[model samples]
Target chain A: MEQKETCFAKRVRCIVKLGGAAITSKHKLETIDEENLKEVSSHLRQAFVPDSTSANVLGMDWSRRPGQSEAPSFVDDFSDQPAGDSESFIVVHGAGSFGHFQASMSGVHKGGLSRPLVKAGFVATRISVTSLNLEIVRALAREGIPSIGMSPFSCGWSTCQRNMTKADISMVIKAIDYGFIPVLHGDAVLDTLQECTILSGDVIIRHLAAELKPEFVVFLTDVLGVYDRPPAEPGAVLIQEIAVREDGSWSVVKPKLEDTSKPVEFTVAAHDTTGGMVTKITEAAMIAKLGIDVYITKAATEHSVKALSGILKGGIPDDWLGTAIRYMS
Target chain B: MEQKETCFAKRVRCIVKLGGAAITSKHKLETIDEENLKEVSSHLRQAFVPDSTSANVLGMDWSRRPGQSEAPSFVDDFSDQPAGDSESFIVVHGAGSFGHFQASMSGVHKGGLSRPLVKAGFVATRISVTSLNLEIVRALAREGIPSIGMSPFSCGWSTCQRNMTKADISMVIKAIDYGFIPVLHGDAVLDTLQECTILSGDVIIRHLAAELKPEFVVFLTDVLGVYDRPPAEPGAVLIQEIAVREDGSWSVVKPKLEDTSKPVEFTVAAHDTTGGMVTKITEAAMIAKLGIDVYITKAATEHSVKALSGILKGGIPDDWLGTAIRYMS
Candidate 1:
């Protein structure tokens, strides 16, 4: 095991969160957004070469496409670098529509194992989320990425009153050291206080970031980025950047909007048992306070790729259109 | 959590091992023996009602099939019992051809994560086995049985020098208490001494038996029962019964076989990364020594169902034609 650990450094390059709504049809139960999944996988393949020795064999063109000026130029030079230097990142995805229905119907998140309906729901929810996890892993595998689906609940992750109490990530660490990307997802887990509860992807990433301390974190959602109000609102505007202080407080940094007095509010989808956008921002802020920048952007877009690869190449590009949350200097 | 523990009771009723060869097409990569799986699941449903209250709703016919005189008579009265009286059992299935190909090709069982091929094989093997697990779970679920797929490796199971050192079965216990059948399978897990190793379903059942202490165990195989020699060999005779003693020694209990001196010998399949038939008997003998009787019988057969339901009701039927290993009284 020690010898194997030396093959790939233990350092995690970054953590990517593929929001459920971005990769799956949130309104349709268990429906995957195939096109978005494929595009995201293709972009990931472009960003990270699997093996340094096989770099020449792939012969992939990493140049920016026509009319996509916002795409970072760093990606164009990605293929030129040695594959051995390829960055390894972890992927965390939302359950989206796959499990939310069953979870909500059974009230699994509320956690009452004594109820037969709740128990049945817990089983059904796991089946749905794990099925989606497999789909994501398969898509990544098709792109020559060795993605292993690691469900949080099955990996001995549990909570006490909805707070994570146990999270065994040794296998996760071993997987990264062995050159495999561990793809995790929101899952229904046993809770000491509630009997069973939903562990959201946002919470999973926060826990991971605290332990692995990745260089940066990327959250790919259905919308462009965080908005002052729900994206559907008429006056909703994307909050370009936010900075978190040591005291866990955050403020909008970019755009310098006049309405800084009001708190950013987001709505949770009816079927989403786990807290939705609000949870993502809360977790991101926690991560930002740890000195790790977190970027929020839409999946399968040039801006998303730019945020992902630009950070891998050392800094986020100026043209990137995403919400960047960083520690206040 | 403590309040919920009083729901179903923590005591396990039984543990069932579904042989890979019995449930899958061993020659076909990743192909499920759908008919066999469905039949076995149907038999399981007939043997155990999911919920006591829903027993009336199911209105299942638990009688012996026509012309199946060997089928135990006790099953005819199963439906007359209260639904709450239904026994709970755990299912453990093998990878069969699904993961064996990948495991053998990558030599993942030999363990060397430092080698890229080995690591890739580990990932592929996991994907194959877990996929089969999902299929089995779905089959059981379709039968109205709450089956949860619990991949050993992903659930924090590992071996040190090929000996299981970490197997957190808290979730399994919780699932059972919640009235769900926790389905586990052979998996590729991190090994402290070897970097990684294959944990066979046989070993998993043995470990589980030691922990859960179920009343009895049933091993479902493709063949009728254990033989003195390979079942396919000429003049091979099924050993009807075996008695295990405190010293970990076992001997033929019935049929008064002429050749008592010779040890039972079985061959391993080419693609089998884990010890096959040999491991099954070895583990069975150990469990028998613990005072728990174990039955090995052909799957999807009336005799198999007899062994299962008969034992659940009280004792094995005298007409059963499977090999029974029990502690010497």
Candidate 2:
């Protein structure tokens, strides 16, 4: 319905991070379930843009609800971001369960303490993560894409004492010269000593993997790869092929999943805390030490974006215990 | 010297995200090193927000870095949202090595494809991770953190439509009700669908651990915790109580740090990115699967945030590596 990208270097960019438990599958207390956030916003617009079925999924606000005591009418929090170019494809997401599931049941991670009462816990996890980022920016404006969300904690946790990194690259190089698909996630930023630290969508996926070094970093996660033992015990094993050896010598090749081996462990709704399996093999060993070749899978599985485009055509998978990391230099 | 806040609460807001690889690490130059961001605007100030050795670092720029033939500066990326609340502490970052390290080194991850710019070997490691997140947002504003920068693909990515989960919590609740401290990083956030993931800082610490649920989920890194092998190897052990028990089991039990650890894996100037140690243990194991209680530590040891406030007042640093599960309802 909105799609506008007529020109702008053809515009097709992306940077994504979404896993608030894949939109409330684990905590739906007050509201937020619009058919499971439009089935994960229709798989985040056909898995990170281009055509996205036909587009049309912007600013979705089904009227809020996380235990509603009152105060947060941030209403459907600001919207308008996500457009396109480079043949038109841009994306950004965050609000798993529409948003910090009531800001992690109201702890406010860093949202000032004492006075924030309206339904506290940092104003209901900042009003359900700003109403699940305006219901995925109205599902990316009903899918044409031309969206926009912005809030890297309002100017990206201040990329330090403002030169605003050249005004945030001249406003994303003027939204890639006026195209779009700017969205972003995680907020509650604003720190000098500490009122918030929750700013990691990989710090905006390593600053867009360092400004569009993209192609792959998929990581959907609920679980589908990397496993050897605590995979819920029993037969255990799923690594697949993380072998990245150049000199860094990394390895972890297990693949062969599906019988519901159940080794991917979560156990059930945050089994008392403490992070699992050494924190996803230490974040897949830091996305294979940032050469970025991570897959992990599970976010509602099945072809998970062509199994992440077969690890960007390198393939791998086959049951994936994988885990290999290298390039440490 | 700013340090006041004895805890009564109210005017003590905070948000600081500075990590574009600690602000252009003295201009290794891939981009935005604007003379090391004008030397982090005279080490930001306000008496350095509460005396960390006599604070005083103060600087603020919402957004605007357009060079490479620039012009589109939304009046220098629109600024206006801090009208007082006095008891403030804000710093956000991004755009250090400016223009996201040359739009992540020319090739631009995938969406700018060329066979993944030569099959992920990294031709520019995405402009050295967009100039190391603008040199960790100008080295935390050259060490006095009252900062602000923005870029989540410029002004927190935006397209047109809206509803990006309430625009990702209304860009961090309107930069914490405008006291400001809403920076963001890991730029190049397009995502109209998928392909670009490490919006990492662990997805802004998992959307602020689901919107300020933060009982604790630190990570810090540069070194200090989460080790057993890589801190340069030789007896590298630094387990320091991984714990986990209840039956999910995990063991290790403290006493290993051998002096903290800390090795974000790779990145001399980027490509071998950071989020290191496998993205700080898989985004601190998905924010400790949401119950919180994960630390990781090291942002430069020394009193290490007062030994992380004495491991945040008690238990869990090794609740036996906490692996609780619930499987999300």
Candidate 3:
């Protein structure tokens, strides 16, 4: 019991979600966006990993740099003088083109293994997602980050009625305790009520956040941040900050809304079996309610590095374009 | 409860162990014996999977060929016609050269997380073993086998005092229930007593046999079978049959040895963290004690096809050279 407490005391610093669209060519069949993935991996390495070659690796020394503004009290808990220290974190990634097509076509998310197509899709989805996970882990490994690929289904994560009910994360916890980064992705898992269903990465991170209770969370997406509408649409505006109330309702705090009556509209990808942007926001809000700040930013961007490195803790900087979800204090 | 009974009724037909030495060039680091693996996979497909292209693929249509002799009453249960029907089974493979070097170098088998080397080695071993598992899955997939890789460690498998204590095989069961072959491998798992230790594939199969109660088990090794000594040693002879007693003692059946005083001498690989040939025999004996026939034979040989296809059931045929360990009736 004493050993367990000691291990728990070294809480995970952060949980990062690598959005499927950001790392893979979502429209293509099972194709990875190699350049973007490499860039994101490098950014992750610079933010969380401490390298002697790079002096001031982000998160190593949490103190403000020259001419940097003060951080908020919520993040003050991490502003200690620990030089050349690596941050402990877990990564949950989306399946993107790797599995979405098969899962969608076979209706695996609907969950009935009695059909041969669903059963075959279950196998194909796992193979595809796990293969992507291996690629991501390899990229992280090349960047000197010790990453292990962990498939949710293989690890006994399951859902009941399309909602996660069980997940044996002891191995995941042990991996973090041993200084290894466990890389998980969206997967096809067995469901009690449905027989099988797609367990999305968004839901996975939300569950992990509730279990591990990291200091903060970051979602690296393809877009700049959450937009009132699809980013490609004309006059679509990014929502900078979302504050969640005790009642679980949320309001946009940034770009002050003159008309508060209109609820923000978000678009989800047509092929995504799991609710897309809406699910991300919902999950992020849940994490925020736990008193942990959540940041959603474009992958491989300077803003993503800043958000991941604890540089956007106090407030979203004028130059930093992303969405910050926080609890209403 | 009714649904559960229906699923359990479709019990796994057989459990096959692909020896590391048979499928991998063990002397070389992380090298797979591609030719041998392909041949073994092809044989497995032919024997277990019913392909329209190949008639009389082994295991289907259990009726003997023109000149073939009768099978034993024990195997009579499977002698009925099963034309163009696939057999349900599971595959458990060893780490081979893939993870042995990393695990041995860091003493991961001894198990201590305090040392950085051990931690790194644990990650390296997982990476190495999982990569090889992917290769095997891909090979099987190409042959139209719905094989899913399930790492023991990832699935909440753990040991206490070097013995398996917990293994949530719900997913394995679900996969089998859904007609997908769950491919498991020797893995590094957390040990309650040692912090971590290597879980041998042999041990895994034995545990599965106890749980799933397969009709038979096959061990595909590089050598013909369990030899009086190592196969390469001078004047080493193959042991055709051994009958295990209720008390767990066994004696050579076919040889009719005058001297029953000497014990079998088996050697282990220097780099294998899991006990090698000795562990195989011990686990095989335990499985045999459960009243299931256990066959040990060289992979990719006609003898292996015979053993796997249920052709060498009543007794060992002169042409089929291998070891059959059976519970004495």
- Predicted candidate 1: what Cα RMSD to the true structure? 9.3
* DockQ pick, better of 1 and 2: 1
Model 2 lDDT, full chain set: 0.40
lDDT of 3 by residue, A1-329 (tens): 00111245458989999999899887666678999998888888888876623332122111112354332122222223333335788999998777776677667899877655566567667777887887788777656566778899887788889988877577788777756688999998888898899999999999889888898999998888887766766776778999998888888989786566776532323212332677788889999999899999999999998998887777778778999999997
> Where in model 1 is the C-alpha error above 4 Å?
A1-9, A50-86, A233-235, A258-275, A310-318, B1-9, B50-86, B232-234, B260-275, B310-318
DockQ scores for all predicted structures = 0.16, 0.04, 0.17
TM-score of each: 0.83, 0.30, 0.83
- Taking the tens digit of each residue's C-alpha lDDT, what string does model 3 give over B245-281? 8898777887655456765532223212332666677
Model 3: runs farther than 4 Å from truth?
A: A1-7, A50-86, A257-261, A266-275, B1-9, B50-86, B257-262, B266-275
iRMSD (Å), candidate 2: 18.8
Give i-RMS (Å) per prediction. 13.0, 18.8, 15.5
lDDT of candidates 1 onward, in order: 0.75, 0.40, 0.76
Model 3 misses residue A265 by how many Å?
3.3
Candidate 1 lDDT over B220-299, as tens digits, reads 99888877666666876667888888999877877677776655432222112332666777899999988888999999
Q: Which stretches of candidate 2 lie above 4 Å from their native place? A: A1-110, A113-152, A155-229, A232-234, A237-306, A309-329, B1-40, B46-133, B136-142, B156-173, B176-178, B181-329
lDDT by residue for model 2 (A1-329), tens? 11112233433333444555554454443244456455555655566554436433322222113454222232133232323332333344555544454344333454443222211233234434544564565554444344555555544343322111211333443454444455566654544344443454544554554444444555554555455554566775555555554443454433445544443333221321422435444444555565655554555445455543334446554444333332334
Question: Candidate 3 DockQ category?
Answer: incorrect
